[model samples]
Target: MKHVVFLSAISLLCTLLVSADTVTNPPHVVQFTIDPATTHQQIDNFSASDGWSMQFIGKWPQHKQEQMADWLFSTENNTKGQPKGIGLSLWRFNIGAGSSEQGDASQIGSVWTRSECFLSADGTYDWTKQAGQRHFMQLAKKRGVDQFLGFILSAPVHWTQNGLATNTGRGATFNLKAQHYHDFARFMADVVEGIERTEGIRFNYISPFNEPDGHWNWVGPKQEGTAATNAEIARTVRLTGQEFARRNIDTRILVTESFDYNCMYRTHPYVRADRGYQIQSFFTRDSSLTYIGDVPNVPRLMAAHSYWTNTPLTDLKKIRQEMGEVLRAHRVRFWQTEVCIMNNDTEIGGGGGFDRSMKTALYVARIMHHDLVYANASAWQWWRSVATGDYKDGLILATPDETLVDGQFTDSKLMWTIGNFSRFIRPGAMRIHVTGRNNDPESATNQEGLMVSAYRNTDNSIVVVVINYSTDEQKIRMNLHRPRITFQPYLTDDVKGNDLKPIRTVQSGSVTSIPPRSVITFVAAQ
Candidate 1:
């Protein structure tokens, strides 16, 4: 089904008449006025990682590879000046540790999860390795991606205590040997320098550890992961900072990617005290542990993953509120650097099953709203941008083939749903306050039921994104502070492909209908 935009008055009248007849449930009247005076966080970027999937897909035929690149990174517009893809401002590059070349001995059974490393066991460097990841980096740069991030899941196998990319056991401990901290730091610095010199893409930020509080000691070939205590992470950062300074590298260090939002503020009884309450442990000046916030090149930002905390709407709101309060007190910013559907607790069941429907996409959008609105996150990013499993993880899915050539691929509504934000809300955009009421018949519903957020771009353009999770059409009455403004609505729904389709033009203080179970972005230039 093609999306019909009621551009003309006749078409609008006919669609309204049909909708009135078909929609028995009374339309929700949402009234919201943007308040630029009450501005919140400055949005840095909306990004995704080119991890396990990119290592292979980057090797795909030129045409297919170019298509994926354009879809993820293109900032170009049609002749009418509408965006083609979600203009992502940041690109995350995975810094591999040579597990892929080691085969089954690497412990990561899936070749896709294993990654190529530039450093060999003999302390030799091969800049030519990880050509696939480099290819994607170049593509992202060519498509106007300004920020590049290099995140690591594990250190080079040779430098690890267990001699494997993964942890030796399920214990929450650092896998990299203490004696080899300097070696690992130097390795990271060298890689950053080599890529910048050779490929002309300088990593603006480098995250050394991921999910440091999680247990990665599971057996078999699932994924390459490791755990580290907060103290260990601080030590690594301090060392890495020294290495970067010694080598005159300018990339900033990103700290402690927590496994969950709670870990950022609360210490789990099951985990070590030093491994949890990361924001306080790492950022606070008087903390018992070594504080790395004062370290050079360490930005005043705390990164955490938004997993398992997105449920029971109230709980989601409460967690983000608590996080925002704590971060604001410390004068530190928050970045939701990683998220995927890893649980089945809410209305949307999550599992390894691949879900290409709007259900998963809406679930993700709701979380994004909570993170941005409640948590005041500066940047939000998804996990793997591409996937090769039966999991509802990737924005784009590809065949399970290890070889990249001639493989089938598909894009999900989740990709376009993210585009509802990333396409318009570029970097430096400030989130403005928007308050509305979704008076559905169900009295138990909250703001999550019909989430709406607004942002002001650098060019003074306003982008309002609305996510309607209900079954009835929503009539939103946007009361802008500035009058006589025209809004162009771009919708992502079941009928339309993942690309954003421009719908009818709307005026300030006028009514616009958002189809049930759809995400719509209304753009108005100032």
Candidate 2:
């Protein structure tokens, strides 16, 4: 009778375990701890790295434009001190090609009306047409942000062979001829001149080509350039640098905003990949144009976009290891300057929340981890500051109501996750090394879940972010390998969410537990 009772109890326990898995929500433990002494990199500053797709910049009613401008531009109205102080340390200006005037042909779809240039119609640079940009630039400058970079999607329509900004006949994109390279160079120089001559601001970096080898195209659509190879990029940089010198413009050229490191410099031909052409041969030491101009590295920055190629942290580490070997051999400064959420496992989720899901937050965290932990990128730039659509993977989401102050602006959890870095880590802060892997033991077994990224602040504060992508909660244990240290934690998760009013806090040291399907940021302050 005793044995039978024991058997009955065991059967009941097994039944309960299976039932638990079928429940609406499962159990999970997710937690993080920090060790300042084991830090390797110091965060200079948290950065926005995107452009003027600002929340209230152009969306406000015409009558309220100046008032919104005053609030955004004036230091007195910057109540949080973040937009001015330890806030966005870098700015990217998108020099549009007057696409809005092209109407439906602009190819960008119906999302945005193109921003007018400072100079309109006459083809001259008109600082006034860029009142919004000028106003924001001045505001950013006043907020103690001095670093600024500019990028142009396309040259003016008049300079293009097709007479339009889109690609030409034969369906193959157009590349400026060798002679026209100087013309393009002059165009960029004039833009710098116009900004300085008119807006009174100098751009320290000018990324002339954006995803140059990209095959995607649209009028207002995603564009495909004439597809310049790596050598062409090098030549353009040399020419652009010379023009800057001739015009006495100090703005440096950051060349080859290639889609990825492998695509930009690897030897393999991308056949089935998103970009099919081959440009990697040019970055090789054996290339004919090994010397960019008579001067080496006339373009100060070798910029690459961290897109598609690397998704997992481990894969990113491997890529970084390979890149380190390649870049070190060539002796170049690398910047993982551009990235967005457009590339991910689940492009769109059936669940409504997936649009701004923890997946977005985790993707940002994972990519940053790869850049900082493995690549050690000098600078990192996110694709856009704010976005109007779900397709582009914008950092900040704009509400649909056009009447709500340029419609409404919703701060994404991804924005807050970025804030986890940008808000505390200031620019010029060196990255410190952390002694832990972003992957959990189950990461390999599960294949698709849970991502983590960590950073050490300038003041020696340790910040660790844990992302739980699983349906249930996740428990994590991190051994600092330190004798003893006092620490604290700040977490943003489903239960806590990213509540700005007061972010939830946890005591450091010992086992840490995180809520299900959430992101937690743990800071161990010195």
**Which one is best on TM-score?**
1
Model 2, residue 245: displacement in angstroms? 2.3
TM-score of each: 0.91, 0.74
Model 2 scores what on Cα lDDT?
Answer: 0.52
lDDT (Cα, tens digit) per residue for candidate 2, span 61-175: 5544434323222223134322321255677777655555566564545425344444345656655564555655665675566777877766655566554444545243434
lDDT of each: 0.78, 0.52
Q: TM-score of the candidate numbered 2?
A: 0.74
Candidate closest to the true structure, highest lDDT: 1
* Candidate 2, superposed: residue stretches over 4 Å from native: 1-86, 104-123, 168-179, 197-200, 217-226, 267-286, 293-300, 310-317, 347-354, 400-405, 436-454, 468-488, 500-511, 524-526
After superposition, the stretches of candidate 1 with alpha carbons farther than 4 Å from their true spots are 1-24, 28-30, 79-82, 217-221, 400-402, 437-448, 481-483
lDDT of 1 by residue, 1-526 (tens): 0122222232122101101112246764534444444467899999999878887788888788888888788878787656767878899999998888889988777777889899988898898888888888888898899899999998998878777887755466777877899998999899899888889989999999988787443331267778887788888899899888887888999977788788888876556676877888888889757689878789989899898788877878899989899898887888999988885544776657777888888888888988998899999999989878888789988884544545888888898889999989999988865543342212222454566677878876778787888777877665554346678888888875535888789876677787888889888776
RMSD after CA superposition, every candidate: 6.6, 11.1
Candidate 1: pairs in clash: 109-221
